[model samples]
Target: MDENYSLAVPFYDLWHEDGHVPLIRELLPPLLKGVERSVIEIGAGTGLVTRVIAQETPAEIYAVEPALGMRSVLVNRLAEDPELLRRVTVLPCGALDVEVDEPVEAIVMISVLQSFPAEQRAELWRVLARQLEPGGRLVFNWRERAVPVPGDLEVMGSYEVGRHTYEVAGQVLEVAGESVTSRFVYRIRQRGVVVSEDEAVVTNHWPAEERLVSELEAAGFSRDAAPEGMEVWRLP
Candidate 1:
């Protein structure tokens, strides 16, 4: 998994260059109006959002990313701005394992929550509940699954055949004749050690607006609308 992520880091970094930074910049000010002291970003991939936070907010920023490949890019990008670099601390850790000596006023998750598995999503929220100061904000964004793609009959038949062969062989075998389906799998890690696997199937969950809201409530978060693609929660 680490190798796969490392290989994709460069592409991911490049993909964010096309106007994403400005988009985040425009959306952040309202949510961050009175926030001060310290702000921490979880899953700070390539520092796209980190750059904006450093520029627009006066608080000390801590960017936490578990992937070394992503962290390296962040370190390099912040190298030139000593003023920004002075207020920033880059941690090679994930949300679950990050320990800040001082309590933070706000925690930003950006597009990171979907990366946690269903079983751990609640626990992740519980961890956040502990880390954040009372009344502090927890902001995140999730890709909404709008419409469902019907199951392909042909693929289902092929999958059945593959299952039969695996049962007969008593060992896992890659079925060559089966149609391959690719989906994003979110995993959780602590300091480079994988703590959980296959946490969420990005495409299969939250297929509607109601489901998205319900999931947030179930995870102990009370959500309010944000500019179109984002959601903001005030921690209780």
Candidate 2:
């Protein structure tokens, strides 16, 4: 888990429930259509995407989330429904450390690729391959990203909750090779007055599409057709 999210947990769902989640809701069902036995979800933050997976398939879910704060919210969300509580098994560990009783049919990773840096992705792929059945599928979202130019603070998203406004602002601090460092500020306001704020500096890696394809191919995965902005690779 990225330590950065530990500070942003309170505002995560508020910002993301409307951000890219709707796209995940739209794209994931088709990707997960035939996974009937089991699925592993890496970085299951706040159960936003987790709920999408649960609703789309009857497969038992091994939801691996490492951050305590995020996991708490995920557990709380699952507790709301008896079926979710029964079917979704939360794994309290990082992606590389995740373990399941057996190889699963598929693994879904949403907005989580950046968390694993270029050097670690090989091992990440290896870990994923080890836990997937032969011919199993790996589904994740990926799009070519333009190199970032250092930028000043800009408001990313804002939402109104009760009388308070929760706002997220970010600034690009540095760009080196495949890594970008940025600072995110989470703010709360009431009656236009700032009430509280927290900040986190997060670094994310962005590998070229060619590099990703090469890495996955080297790891024994072959490309499969997928919707735009999503990639599906199958182990053979």
Would you list the C-alpha lDDT of every candidate in the order shown? 0.64, 0.93
Q: Which stretches of candidate 2 lie over 4 Å from their true place?
A: 1-3
**Counting only residues 3 or more apart in sequence or on different chains, how many pairs clash (N, Cα, C under 3 Å) in candidate 2?**
0
lDDT of 2: 0.93
| Cα lDDT of model 2 by residue, 94-177, tens digit | 999988999999999999999989989999999999999998999999999899988999999999999999999999999998
Compare the candidates by TM-score and give the number of the best one: 2
Point to the candidate with the largest lDDT: 2
Clashing pairs in 2: none
lDDT of 1 by residue, 134-178 (tens): 777888765554343333222111111221311100111122121
lDDT score for residue 55 of model 1:
67
Candidate 2: C-alpha RMSD to true structure equals 0.9
